[model samples]
Target: MQNFGLCLVIKQELKPIPLQNVVVEANIVDMIAEVTISQIYKNIEKDTIEALYKFPIYEAAAICEFEAEIGGQRKVKGIVKESKEAAKEYTEEVQKGHGAYLLESESKDIFQCSVGNITSGQTVVIKITYVTELNHDSESENIRFVLPTNIAPRYGSSEYSSSSNEGKILNPDVVSYSSKANYYLDLTVTCRMTSTIQNIESPSHKISTEMNIDENPKISKITLTEQITYLEKIFILVVKSKDLDQPRAFVEYNPETQTNCIISYNKKTFIYTALTSQEILTIQQVARVKSTNISTNTWINTLEAFRHDLQLPGKIEDIDTKEELECQLVLFFVSCKQQNGKDYSVQSIKTARFAIACHINLYSKIRPQDINNKNVYPDLYNAITGKIKILTKSGFGESRGADAFTESEIQLIVNHPAMQTDSPKGLLRRIFWHNAFEFALRGGEHYDLKIQHFVKRKDGGIDVIFYQSKCNQIRLSNSNPKSEIISISPNENIIKDYELYFTKRPPQCDDAFYLQSCNQAEVEFTGYWYKSAHVGRNSLNKFMNEIALVTGINCDDRKFSNHSGRKTFVQYSKSRGISDNDVMSVSRHKNPHSLSYYERPKTVLQQNTLTQINDIIYKKRVVTNEAKNQSTSFTAALEFYKGSISENCKFKALAYLNYHIAYYIIENNISPLPLSEKPRVPFQEIKDSQNIQLDEDCIKKFLQGNTFNNCNITFNMNQ
Candidate 1:
């Protein structure tokens, strides 16, 4: 009843306020921090063994099952149009790599010669009963051919293969076979071959870093009166000497251990002391003591005794008098408070005193050798050293700093490779952007942000703050709190050649077409763009185009849209892993998934690939002992092992079955020690069977809500 009355009284006193989304005029201070990044993409290569070994000069070549477009001189009636095109395309392709050359490039004659054909013969009558259109759902086309000739050709494995086989070329335009007239051979045969479209991509990236969040930002209540508990008023004779040649002098007021009490030499005696670890109290822990200083000394309590550790100290400079030493010992006490919510806290208090002079080391220059506080990680040195500090009194963790080039650079880069493109402005933005992004990306997915931003930092640079969102609705997916900012330049270095290459102008807009025109484009920070050499920032326009292309989002203007992709991508990626914060800092968010968004589709080719895999695996789920004699990647061992799955593959049963076989072989065989990674087949790779007809009664029954596993039967556990 008392609680009820109290709640009723509180309800009358509490008042609610409405929030107005007003356009408050406030400048957003940004602290720019920078890190230089150099990205170099290298191409990896794989070896291939061609099949001309079976077929001699007149030997039967490839047996393919792909479509052939027949574009003959005339309309070859029964032959399909694709068949004719395939014939012509094959002929042209075979003629490409048929000549014999010397093996050495330096040879007067031909150093190397091309002798075999990938496509050796053509049907007198083209009959491509099976034709397949190029599918954009997969990485490559699905098609296979036979190399029957037994002739061995010299193989040069290079990412760039200059030597082309003379057989039919299976290019994007056409799949064909080329055959020379065999005077003695006139056998009628159709190469019944198989093929498939396979995908090749790099693996996902993996990285980790030291943790940042800790209680060091909490407030302490230490007091000034409670400062040095043992203040001394020992009476002693005073003396001073101005001459550098003459030594300073002093005498101890009372008898004490000679070493601990004073330093006497050349008529000068010096006294030095600090609150011993036990003598000093933090207001919260004053009752915990077990030392002799607490009992014996009365007038001016002796300094507290603490732990013993030693370092060879740099000798104190020569002081002319005891007064000079007295001038150096002035001390101060500091403290703060936390309201309620938190259960624990840590501080970044100023812990040491030293005169600022050439001989004195500032916290900034205090080398690691001078530090004994190893509990703090190397990264927190600046924080502990007071080079940087936390100030949250006004609420949302704001920081400031003052020569601000580093801050500017950080901002410039942040806006890039995302907003600005690699262009000058974008480049600068990226340099700074990295710092803020790097900090946020580290928060991980479980983070719940309130407000995080970066503005002017102490270096006359940028400062960053991160917090949980205050928005009521889920406008954005980011939920992490505890963010950071920095100060620095955005670009690693300036690259002006891109601008000059396009002649000093942004491209002019085609008033009639509303499109920007760049006939002679130049590649700059913003990327490759060509505008009227006399007009605008061509690079900016190109950046816009790339942004739209890479992302489906449209920008209001080309420049605006072009530059915002990187920034916006941050939002999207933050939603993906939450823990991907660190990776995002490096601008490496879209790799493995990029393949999924851009894929090809062609069924026959896919079937051919499956067929090849099946053949390689033999009749068992696992590669049999027979398959072991094949090859390593395509090993007798791998016979049970089907090839790897695509990078962004979603899981399913067909893929499961294929990989299951491979798994069994590894589990039971002696080819290797570890199990192979199971394949992940993409449900996205499969085209929707929208056109399939269904019985009306059956459809009605299904629509009435029969139990089904999400309607993707291929995903059914049992094939």
Candidate 2:
């Protein structure tokens, strides 16, 4: 059964702000990230999602003032706010050929120079972008608002970008745009800025909306990260058998809570608590936004520089985007726990790196002239370009249950022709292949096979001890990297070790059935018909694409696709808000290290997560209060808590309309975003600007009378 739901990003956007002296400051309040809550939760259950938010807190304190440069240029001189006082110095893990960058909605995943400069009085239009790890869709399809809403909040367009107050632009190609409003904060006001603004938008299929301004700090640019939790949902912990001293095995949960901590089959009891201290350390270190390791940056930087070159007056629009791009693979560990309280780990595969590789693969064979002339991009072209190679051992262990992978699988990836080749595709492919072994671990039954350390005899099959990053370097003082812990290799030893624990089941005969899904990419890859890799993305992706087309499933178009699998598992864990140690036990990743990646700006989805956490705290309390009763298990308290949230927790918005649309875009796709509104938002001057009657036709089509307040505004979309 596909008990887990797909987490595809239906929409997204990205607004790049070049670090220029004059335009150093950025804001998010009046930007696209700002919107009314109703549009955000229009169709989804409010309790099921959480968000990872990152917004820059300008070094306001450091800004003494702005100064003019030698050429009469102006720039701001200031230090950013000091790093979080609570943040400890964390040494970045050494990883080659792996990093992160935002994929643009209109622009492909390829990062390129987007915005430039002008004078302070010129108005710049911005866009928003989001990177989603949810359900799959076509590669880089632009979702323009069927009707342009470039105006401010007050006056109405055919629709707001699904939320928020925006204006209408009958012609999209027009550059120097103007708005109706004059002031903005909670509202978009008209002003002018100098330069081409980087626009970022949400990827959700938006419904027309109108924004109402309220009192508060407005948002502009935002940085997001997904918070993964609650991986222990399918089962609970118990002992192996009834014997006082016997080998323990992980089992599934039974509703009843027994008096003894031991399992019905075995009497062995675990010594650790549900959540380990190692797990409580929420974040390891806050990293620089979109920073990349050297090896991985080669392609990324090259792509960045190349994109910059493309914006020239004579710049060709049809340049081979895939050839000029760079990509890498990275892996992070995850945690997992079985019914018997035994901890295990496994590897998850990543497909994001592959996506990057696919793009780069497209570029290798493209000659400058061919790129200039050809409209069709092929896959096999990557086998030709001559480029250097770099490899990254980005072993991430943020989740506990995702640690038991062997190197053989990694070797398979590392040795691919593309990986070993000097071409861009080769370098990209090699990184892709090498990173595969890290996230190869699957959940459920596959995780059961990773139980290497028997309770009776402590044995670590392959050791993976993590050292926390302190002061920017991994403090390996107490950890050993040489230990042989469980790995993802299909070598005889791993297969045997796995077979010793979990039995192989017959393949599911269902049409959509798949097996051993860790990153949860178990769907088909190829389209309806088999196709050759005339424009190959290496044998691996070509083969996968074929399957995807046939199965209507998709493989990740990004590198570190394996790691994404483990990340998905962690997201599942966060959904349940399972105890840290439980997360570690199931993921097999150590606790302290596991907590680093998930700590981010909390979103609406986390409301439910905290609700679960509150349930945990309550259960802990009940365990203490009812100790005298001796009739109920500690779990009874938890059951009571789960019941309360299930029955009583009301689905609501955090900040009504302004942020309600956030959840939709982050999980969907990306669009453009603006920093500050110049010339004000359209609706702020609704009474004076356009005739409200102009929008009558489209207004009826959008709302269809879903739930209209007295305002009852109308629109036709065409101004």
Candidate 3:
């Protein structure tokens, strides 16, 4: 087997730069601003290349329009649709070698734009328009407008990027920070104020201001003095006006929707009101829509129904009393239904309640603090806690975590015909299963494992080291305290499987540990089991399920996913009386409470415990001679092996002996071998029958003067 010690060497390459220029134009009126950002991309490479740009937007901003001009001729406008549908369309266009543009929201503040199939020397311009409210100082008459330019690296996995359409939207090329783009940013802002403008300045950059006071004293324009600036920092401009302390109200009529919206601002408090020809309603009431797809939009629909019943707007300012809020929540929880028009399950209801609590907490943070009390939503906060007791009593919360595999199920899986086969796929399955169960690896963690992570130890065991995982992404210090190292004892069967698999692995394959298998005919002819392609993520995730199906196990009643291996390891270790800290060392769990979630007992173990308790209570406890003998014999064997085996071959000899002893007991349907004063060959039958090879001198030395029950048996050495 090839030895890959610790680190992997990655070749450094020059990253590509496709973004050329960015221009921003903004028009501000009082507290609201409408901005347009234009990004230009050019393909300077000889062949066609896709350009992907990730940028930041204000969290509260609402994107209004997106348009693109490909090669400065063809104009394409973006349409709002479901994410999956839009991704499908973009993929189809890219597959046809045609120009396509896609703008998607990665998070509340992060956005990604892709220009696909940009031919050589082609220039594409993308424009995005959005409207946002200016940040106003509570104590001063100044309003601040901010335009985000740089998107900082985020830590967790993106919820949007983890969907089914991830492959189509997420490009690894866009994630590189080494690329330096030859680009310039130009920004122009035109501000219109209701009161007289006192001053306009930028604290972040040098800016030039122009006032058309002669034509209209309320209008002012601001621009960057340098004209050429890099997109490295946020652009902020503060506008101070006189006599801005008075309350103000503005109404805008939308002819398209035939509705009038009134915005009232007074002392940092804003109230939105909607007016129609028939009656006046709150903004939430007017925006409410009866959604037909209840499954995906249950949270929103439930909130809308609650507000409609009480004639309350979505804003926290519209809510008056604690009693009213509690009543509204009670109504929502009782009336909410699933997609099939049935009441939600206990878990689903709990999830919905969590979503509502998150909304309340968010509003409390953003709402202005009162002079009398610092807590903004005391009533609402109290309501959330008060309802929990009632909800729990109604059986609204229950946890149904992933199920662990039983001992019999594990035996069936490892001894299945597919696992024992000599084909390439079979070998891959064996390695995958063993690694997952032994190391307690999470599902997605297997996707990034490389050949370099495995290191051979001096004790003849293998140590699998993990440098990074989902729980530990950022390493703050030089010490690798968080890295998990799992040691595999030197077992004959396991070592042989690994050696054969490595020998048959294709040389063209990269450093990825897992590879997809080639056809059986190709493997037979070329002696290569796997091709150059790495295994697909979906295949790795469903590997355990495939094994269950082949073993004729029903998966409908219980979940047997890739996570089952991890759960099984935890449960099995606990059954063997392993300490929590010892298990945590192998599992690499930082929290003891998190480890408890995987410690569910199997039905058989639960029944055995109950029976033991009953026997003790009834004074019918009977300790069998076979049980005592089995325990004593195993303990004595362990001590004997520890004292007799040589330092160089201790691990291998002990593992081989233990495996054969278990096999002997199971084959003969008898009790464990007992230690005796006379010599005997406990594994003589296995030694003569099995075709496995081992060191002859080491075996002879170990059995030369060993005593076992006075039954002497001949030993055969096979090469």
Give candidates' CA RMSD values in order.
50.1, 44.8, 30.0
Q: Which segments of candidate 2 are over 4 A away from where they belong?
A: 1-480, 487-560, 574-578, 585-719
- Compared with the true structure, the alpha-carbon lDDT of candidate 3 equals 0.66
Tell me each candidate's TM-score.
0.15, 0.18, 0.38
How many steric overlaps does candidate 3 have? 2
Report lDDT per candidate: 0.26, 0.27, 0.66
lDDT of 3 by residue, 63-126 (tens): 8898888788889998888988889999999999888877888776556666777777877777
After TM-score superposition, what is the CA distance of residue 519 in candidate 3 from its true location, in Å? 2.8
Could you tell me the TM-score of candidate 1? Answer: 0.15
- Candidate 1 ranges with C-alpha deviation above 4 Å: 1-572, 578-719
Candidate 1: residue 481 lDDT (0-100): 32
In candidate 2, what are the lDDT values of residues 1-719, reduced to their tens digit? Answer: 00001111224422221111111122221111112100000112223221111111111111122111211333222222333321111112111211111111221111121112222332222222221111111222111211112121111212222322223232221111112223221212121111222233434221121122232112122221222111111111111111223333323454687333433323223333575655553332223111223223444444344445445222222333544321111101011223364422212112223323433333344433232112432322221111001111222322332221123433443444433433323332332222223332322212122222322213433332222111223334636433323333445543343333222212322111122221113223421111121222233324222322333333344323234344544554554557777555535565547655643335745864565456457754222222222223323332333344322231211122112223222222223334343322223343533443313233223222222222323222231
Sort the predicted structures by TM-score, highest score first.
3, 2, 1
Among these predictions, the greatest lDDT belongs to 3
lDDT of 1 by residue, 1-719 (tens): 00100000123331111111111011100110111111111111131111110111111112222111111221122222464564465456446743111111211111111112212221111121111111111122211211111111111111223323224322121111113212221111111111111211112111111111132211111111222211122111111112212333333354464443343324222323676666665532432221212222210111111001112122223333333322322211112222252211222122222111212222123322222233533333434333323334423243111101123333443333454543433332332233223432221211222212434334443343433222122223547434333333333231222223223333443221111333333444434343432222344334434433333433343333232334434443443444454433343333545323212235645775575467557854464443343223222322322343543232332354444434333433323223353212222243444232333243334322332222332222212
Q: Which run of 10 residues does model 3 get worst, by summed lDDT?
A: 1-10
